[model samples]
Each structure stands twice: as C-alpha cells, then as structure tokens.
Target: MSTAVKHDDFQLPVMSGYAKESYDLCKAHKLSFQRCAKCKTFRQPPRPLCNKCHSFETEWAPVKGTGKLYAWTIPMNPIGKAWVSYMPYVAAIVELDEGPRMATWVTDVPHDQLKLNMPVKVWYDDLTSEVTVAKFKPA
Candidate 1:
C-alpha cells in the first residue's frame, strides 16, 4: 500500500553520479555537457565513456545556451499527480548548437505558436534548495 502526495508536490530527478554533476553546473546557470576530451564530442545525460572513441576522459564544457527546437508536444494528460497542474505544457527536444540534443521544457510561449526549428535559449529553474533544472524558451 502507498499514500499519494499532494498534487503541488513536484517530482524531481534523483541527483547522483554523472547526473548530479550536470545539475550542479545548471544550478550555476551554466548549461554544460560532458565533452569527450579526445574527440571533443559533447554528450547529454552525462556518461562515463564516450560512445565514439570509448574515451573515459571528459570535461564539463559550457554551451552558448542557444538551440533550435527540434520537436515538441503538448501533453494534455498529466503523466503523474505532480504534473496535473502543468498539463498542456510544452515538452520539447532542443538541439544545441554544440551538436547534442536535450529533453527539456519550453515555456513562456503559447502552445499554438511553437514551430519546428524555432530558436530557443536555456533558462534555469531553481526547483529546490539543492536542485536546479535547465529549461528552454523562445530566443
């Protein structure tokens, strides 16, 4: 048996390991990705080894915080209780100028006005005392 939390209780990702490092950077308002030192390729969802060169050496490199909206969707149905209030929000895939694409929220614009390949910029939301999420907005 389980109990449900309030709808206002937002669910956040668990910050640990490689993911924690990424969020830590975002907490500082710096949108960065794990870049392979050998090949200079940037990657999202920070990982231990490079998929291209299998290199273990990586650096947290900041991006220009600009990207294009590759795709998006408005979820009319909440995925969870925490998202009930955020229904109809834009869930988007942003392709960064640096080559890697990230899943993020695109806010501050009407749902009907969103266009494919529209310019977007990164923004940080301080969700909690220790967590900050990186989102996007029209640029």
Candidate 2:
C-alpha cells in the first residue's frame, strides 16, 4: 500500500490499539475487521468482546472488500479548515458482504447519483505515512 496522496492540511485519524492494528493492515492494503474467534461474527469499531456470543477471544479478519451502500449523507459544511476543500463529501454506511456495516465515505460517484443498495467496494486513502483510512466506491 502507498501513502495517501496529500491534498492540503487534512488531519489524519487518531490511532489507538485496535485502530492502530486496523490502520497497519490498511497500510498493507488489506481491509480487515474484528471477528469473534468462537462464533465467527465480524464487527467494526473493534472492541474487546463479541457482542453476539459474548466471547472474549477475537481475531482480525480480512473482508472481501465488497458491499452494498446502505445509506449516506452529504454534510453541507466542512468540519474544519483542513476539510474545507472537500466540502459536501458523501459519508455512508456500507453493509459488507460478510454482514457488518461500516461507516465510510463513498467515492468515485456524484452525491446525486448515489442510490440505496448500490454495489460498492473498499478502497484505501492513505492520510499519512502511518495511516490509511478505508472508503467505498462504486463497484
């Protein structure tokens, strides 16, 4: 994976334990999420336990990187100065083929053209040398 192409002064996502792991995998161009080792359930916003089976054991599982656009929104104002250039970006909820819904951004399509249940695939945007964020694009 390559570092994200820098545009302006956009701030990168903060890295924590599981989030660091996720970002590291994305740096390698892999799209992974936390999965319960016992019951095999996938989850995002990676946590310490499985919500479904209440299991403590978990693993980082790579996903197919394909999914459907469940929903989306285009905020009228940018959050801050760094995001000013990219105002009105499409933020979306994508339901992965494996059943987990992730919060991501929809790219490569105009906001007006976005549709519910539209096919999409995971794409990486390297925000810095050490961070890569996962986004979705029309498949």
Q: Top TM-score: which candidate number?
A: 1
Residue pairs in clash, model 2: 4-126
C-alpha root-mean-square deviation, each candidate: 5.3, 3.2
Residue 64 accuracy (lDDT) in model 2: 92
By how many angstroms RMSD does model 1 differ from the true structure?
5.3
* TM-score of each candidate structure, all chains considered together: 0.89, 0.89
Q: What TM-score should be assigned to candidate 2?
A: 0.89
lDDT of 2 by residue, 17-54 (tens): 88888889988989888899999988677888889999
Q: Which stretches of candidate 1 lie over 4 Å from their true place?
A: 1-8
- How many angstroms is residue 17 displaced in model 1 relative to the true structure, after the best TM-score fit? 0.5
| Model 1 worst lDDT window (10 residues) | 1-10
Q: In model 2, which regions exceed 4 Å deviation?
A: 1-8
lDDT at residue 72 of model 2 (Cα atoms): 88
lDDT on C-alpha atoms for all candidate structures: 0.82, 0.82
